[model samples]
Target: MADQRQHVQGTLSELGTPLARCTFVIVDLETTGSRPGEARITEIGAVKVCGGEILGEFSTLVDPGVAIPPSITLLTGITQAMVAEAPRIEAVLPGFLEFAALDRGTVLVAHNAPFDTGFLRAACGEHGYDWPAPTVVDTVTLARRLVTRDEVSNHKLGTLAGFFGVGAQPSHRALDDARATVGVLHGLFERLGSFGVDTIEEVRGLRATPTSAQRGKRHLADDVPESPGVYVFTDAKGDALYIGKSANMRKRVRSYFTAAETRGRIREMIPLVEGVTAIACGTGVEAEVRELRLIAERKPPYNRHSRNPERSVWLRLTREAFPRLSIVRAVRDDGAPVVGPFRSSREAELAREALHHALPLRQCTQRLSPKKTVPACVLAEIGKCGAPCEGHESPEDYARHGEAAREAMTGDPHRVVEALTERIAALSAELRYEEAALYRDRLAAFLRAAARSQRLSALAAIGHMVAARREETGWEICVVRHGRLAASGLMPLDSDPHAYVRALVATAETVPPGTGPTPRAHASEMECVLHWLDAPGVRLVELDHPWTCPSSGAERYRDLTDWDRASPSTTRR
Candidate 1:
């Protein structure tokens, strides 16, 4: 034991160069699953190390109580039977937190920090421990930076141990992985001289705070309206990051960015986020209508459903040579009637799963292996899809069934679902188990969406629509006139949404394609005076909330910058 301690001291001293004054708590975990939130840790091991010395180490096995998956048991060599008898996380957490908070402060270090820290935080929350979220250093991240391409076959603790010429204890156990991570840290220190790892304070200083955004929202100078309109999120460089809609501009605009999904990305983004501007509408209904249009115009990355994902080809679902689902850029408006006009190709594919539940439809996306010899898709055998992929069903026979599906998804959804239930009983009587299952799942999602859907049939119809989600710098406008796309324009919008959208729509005939139009153009000034003469019913909406307005209220609009180019006397409404 004394010899092992000396050897460990010698190894850790080498890391002295890269890590200046910082102390680190080396940690490891055996988790029940890969995802952070749901998974429970079965074991935890950690050690406090500083100035080339091991101050202390703690290791404990936890009774997760939940039966471990077989694969996880094989990897960790800890069976459900072994953990079944161990102490709970609550009993083990106090000792763990004690070691973690040792010596004033220490950053946690782990081979795969996310795996360890995720489990640790989760356990702390479960046990009600005061684990003030700790800063972490990933040895895995460090090894990637330090290790040469040929030296390591993989970055797992076993592979990393082999590269550093450090032998690991029984692998997969939390204590062993922790030992391996410490070895990697020592190896990196010897290889790269004097690399500085920041203390928690220094690391946290890199984070961008939400104060600026809060201040921007609460700015006394902003012109806010109670109506509906669009809002623009922009970076310091004046690049549009996101575009959103709100009905109550005062309340809805403030609700955006409730919290950053990922702190790392948001921290990097915070200092760069400069301001947000809003457009106001008279009602929530109008806001929802315009929100879809604005999304098609802007194409913001933050807004996934709104942006057109590339490589996403819409399934036309044509009655073609394949007699199955056919891929295309848009849903076919060709002679063969389309079953769906889905928002996305992915959603269209997922819709297949739900379709079987909602409607009695013959479905396929395969064009390979001739019938009789060809085996059905796994989904077909498992009763998730109808086995039409094998050419067992003809388009003429399935046409009525397909029509029911189209109604459920794109048209009269109520009638579509009601029609499918009657058909499922008939298919079951015919012993078509595969056909029944497909309709079962599809109907479930359709009903769920329908139950949640407050949509009254497309009342104020706009023409063929193509929309893009807005980003930080400028807003986007996708114009579809009479069921055909006129064009798309990206334009900077005013914080006061009522004035902004009016300016945008009134001058829609002039802005250049691709990017947003210049703010405060002379043509816009001339058009606003003549705005009511054209389309007077432009609308605004707030997202995830029930507020809206028409573009009619005078108090609903305000321009932040007062440099107004007055409308000439010749301009008449």
Candidate 2:
């Protein structure tokens, strides 16, 4: 046992502040009930330890001043007779608090902290003693995050004690349970060390701690700059491992090497990272756009989203005698209007459903000649579709419904918005809340797509423009073309801002218009720029044309996206 204690102390010293140097108070309480205000603590047991050695121990039976219930007696084996001669809580608490005070950095450990802490706090409040809030570690929360369900049947104190081969078994007695908890606590610390959790900060934020391999690469972040930039982590083969943007490249890059990064995939990839490279930007907005472009171009293996526009799906209104909404992989300039660049086919399908339900447009996939007749699908009989396949609706009339759907997809979304709003209201009134939420989600998807389309359209229509926002030391200038950032730079504050703006415009990098039908890369870059322009206190210094969303369009539905409200109707304009 002496050798084991020395080994534990040695292992802790190699980590941050030697765990051996810190004081931990493992506490347990036998209580009458779960809550503190309503129930009272029958017994308090605590063991204080440092350097893997027990420094002190405290145990007491408290007179709760109430009759002990039969169920409580059965659970804890503490009867009124057991505490008949015991000191009252008011008399016992003061000594316990003194014993637990911090000579070194002190921490309170409990199986499930709230239960113990809550009762202790209540006891202090009732007795008119101020409760000192100390650093607390809940083994229950730690176990849940670190241990898999397969490792143990449960996170209960007894289960953990048995699993860790604790000498003292919890027998519904406070002291035994407190001792067992100390064993469990040590076992957890050992497990966390394997995952690169060493310091008290890492232990407190264990859930976000990176893997041991990632922590081993802390040296790689030494040279990173403290500036807005895009960073790429690379493998030994010189291939990109992961790409990210940050307002502070040094801080963000350093976080990957510490216990602060919680992402499982990033932690796995960090071991492969042999180096990191960064490109500084004038502003956070520029860094974001550069990150997106690099991720899209490099196709980094670890980048999950926005790496490939080809994989994105869109809802298209096909050009035919009777237009129908269909989910397609790529958008084409085939004179057929498209609603998205939606993140997934599922979202596009939802938007398609919302539009179909609102507008009496055809839902067929077949190409119908103006005179040819084809069998209609069940959607026609259900009154969801216009049945243009069966010639039940004339081309002119079907075209009007198709036009309305197209309008909603492009700019005007009032009809579709009202339809979904009414449906959500009806479903909520009927107590079909789940179905209402589904409709609400579908409505939000449509509105978001419509809003994006309108914003992109407005920006693209301007062709070319220059905008500037005032900064502390200079003017941040950006040259935009077809809604995308053509170039951006920082110009020192000059008496004549126009001269610096011209120089910035001349020096900025030129990116040609995208060749793809949707211009997704350009659209993404434009979205980044739009986000920057909309930032608070940003002022547009110059423009070739006015930049604005459609006056009475999908932009108005921005408020409806707040789905957390009890009723959308109450928040709707």
Candidate 3:
């Protein structure tokens, strides 16, 4: 570690305030260099203030142990040779902190503080003196806030001193600057009547603007409001800090903000925060779905789930109109076409590879985004994409087929069954039993998918995104979305058999309308699934258990694990 670091720990805890506090030292340094990494402090000066009164003043030239820059020679009368025999920070910093009595509520007051504080902290951390230093207030941020244009054009210490007719005498001398700073702070504090900065305890207790910002980001977080949707906090980086889902998003989110008023850590976070974002959904169930999808995309930092958004992509229907098929991609880029409007070749490749499954469209060779000059894949000859190659199919036809596939993957799975049903009816009417049987088997598989769709629908009803995993103890269920956690329930081998049956039913229910299975549809399946997942005796468990019930291929349990890391819908804004 460097000498600067010695001051970090030693002075970190030593930062404090004035008033009912002990003496604070406003200090300044004239340096031979711009950065602590290379620059050496040429001069150090301090003015001690206690109970709003100057207690003492001190200034000194430091033997930089290095040659002073010519600029330094012109600016302050200190020369290259003047400080060659002077004291170093090792000798001066400790005395400064001691006089400041930073260990006793004495804060450091400086201008453009981070630069100086950063240097000071670096020094403390290095010396092993570990400053345990008191708080350092930047007169810069304070003066801009307190001095306002009506009183002054600039807030530089020299400017403030000039306003009070003190002029910059002794000019760049460290002691003079420090003295001038203390005087300026005193004048501004008296004029403002109050610092207007209440205690963390006082601000935490109120849900109003905890920290000021634009309208969108104000303190609407008192209680996550009463609404069905997801809530988010986005920092200045446009990165999500947290995400949550609730029928009462207002109240739930508000609960986190208001409830933590007493937590010092939370108080610090609230003030640094920019604002919150929300997505309103159709139902609390819809909110959960949307939340899961969002969590999958926007990995807000404050969210435990936020970290996972980038690693996983959800299977989404690309075309959505007709040739129903699935594609794995981040949600935000959905509208950008693989077939048009100019897209990169890499994205097209990824879209195909991720969406590639045991399905027929897996063999496409067509370029994605902005229809390409080359068209179709080898599978097209066999009717996979209607042979868009060699102009056998029109661009409209290609789009239609792709649309159909996308639609099949998205819309109701019933559409697949309906199309298959028509094929089966035509085959049977032609008395082609063998072909009809093939259609029948395909229909069975289609019917299986339809049943699974019902299970996904039911997951939403319970206001959760469920991911069941096996553990040594039993099955663990992680219900989450975005970065916010909704619930984690476990199903142990020792649990009630009835609840297990219900879970299986969600995965095994008969098909709904329009599929090749049964023509009947029931609205209650989702409700029943909700009742089973949430029944009181449920416990949280890991899903890796050996004896857990098997899931059909359609059950997206793998997605739970992957999406546990996968970003929800990717963001555009």
Candidate 4:
């Protein structure tokens, strides 16, 4: 029985800090006014509780540095004489902050958190003391979730305290009110337990009420282990309806039944879901990669991302006598420079147009023969093309333009930007503002795709790499091969990471090389890896290759144009 109880506690702790193990400093304050700037806190009181027992208490009267208001004094019975010899807020704040110990997993609780925390933060700011942002819990919010209007007239501290029959009662005093709030917090926890909310995260995310469908489907998540992983919602035939990933598998699955699951499509998908399949992963990044792979393979109806990675288009130089820019779905190893795995063909076309504005490459799609001269289209007359179709530009001459375009696509794009900028400036000077704006949009579209392609290529060139990031529990280590997440694992706090890294690397998935920048891996997966690598505190554990990108990649030219703002729909990755 003792072993079983320990097992249950251990399981609950894995989700997050279990509510029973959390230390809460219930606080209450009396003030001269309601709002922060308009008010001054007069009295501060707190009771630190862990596992329903009081560890210590902190109470102090603060001098507001101003006269107490008559209405406030009358309500709280704190007369001006009562605080004449009290310590100023500067002295009192340090003691209060020390007692809270917010940095050491001590959660701050208040009846109305905003009011108390606001005044405290305001006081800290005014005195030039650093405000340690604490994880705060509001008893009023918790009570409203558990005790409806039918059970209590209102969720005020006094009403909740009286309903719970706590030892202390609110008497418009800080210490008494704080003591009353602790009891109300404990009472709410009792109610939350019935709903299977055992962790601090669950307590914080508790909803007022759950949908009937959500309540009925709660059992679907019962078998999910408490770990980071991917989850699949399946219909009766065991086909996937939706797929998702989260740091905690059990917590995320259970949340689908709560009111917090508010997405319309997901709400609709829930009624059809007959079961959930959980795949435990070693880290959050691995779960994300797994979710993307599963979604692409299964094509889950409810998943929008990575569902159609094959549909991505690219802008590449065609293999012909007079090679022209073409939008293709698949990349080839023909050595022609390719620009994208664009989200859609429309974006690829936009990027193509931008490149055309820089180089007078032939706009025609038909095969052109250097030996035979064919009549050129009107684009040749407009000088938009070098008219290779009409044999006006020889294959040798067209090759020069193609090589320049190739340089812009693969290496530096300064010439492309300079050419476009000259045209835009010339148009704007001629009062052709509309034409200039169009050129600007095209430039942004091209740069956005180029920058994303370069970033993806840099990471995808590496054969094998291992990286780790510091987490509360330990290090989140990942094994990446050609920018694909091969495997992930955790090294417990205070343990050597070398052995764990070796084990994870040995068990990682074997990935084969593919053609182009993002070899063997989906562009989305590479982009995810780039984001993780760039995040703060990530340490490179091992690397087989020196990962690098062209210094003149389009990313360097972002400051030269308002690309991000003008081309908001520019597809990345």
Give the best candidate by TM-score.
4
Rate residue 264 of model 1 by lDDT: 51
Estimated TM-score for each candidate: 0.33, 0.65, 0.35, 0.76
Count of backbone collisions in candidate 2: 0
Model 1 stretches with alpha carbons more than 4 Å out: 1-20, 194-573
lDDT of 4 by residue, 1-573 (tens): 001122110121245678889999999999999999788999998999999899999998888889998999889999899999999998888788888998777899999999999998998899898888988888888888789889999998999998999989998889989999988999988987557677787677665566688889999999998778888999999999988887778887887787555567777888899999999877777777788889989999887556888777889988788888999887776666788877568777878888988888888888888778888899898988888887788889989989888888877898889888788778877777677777776776777778777777778778899999998888989888888888888789887677778888999889876557777788877877787899899999899989877888888887644643543233220
The candidate with the higher TM-score, 2 or 4, is 4
Model 1, residue 393: distance off in Å is 92
Indicate whether candidate 3 or candidate 4 has the larger lDDT.
4
Compose the digit string of candidate 3's lDDT tens values, residues 58-166.
7788887788778888888889678877888788887877777777766678877777776767767766677665666676776665567798888777788877665
Give me the candidate number with maximum lDDT.
Answer: 4
Residues 81-130 of candidate 1: C-alpha lDDT, one tens digit per residue: 78877898888887777778833557788887877777777777776765
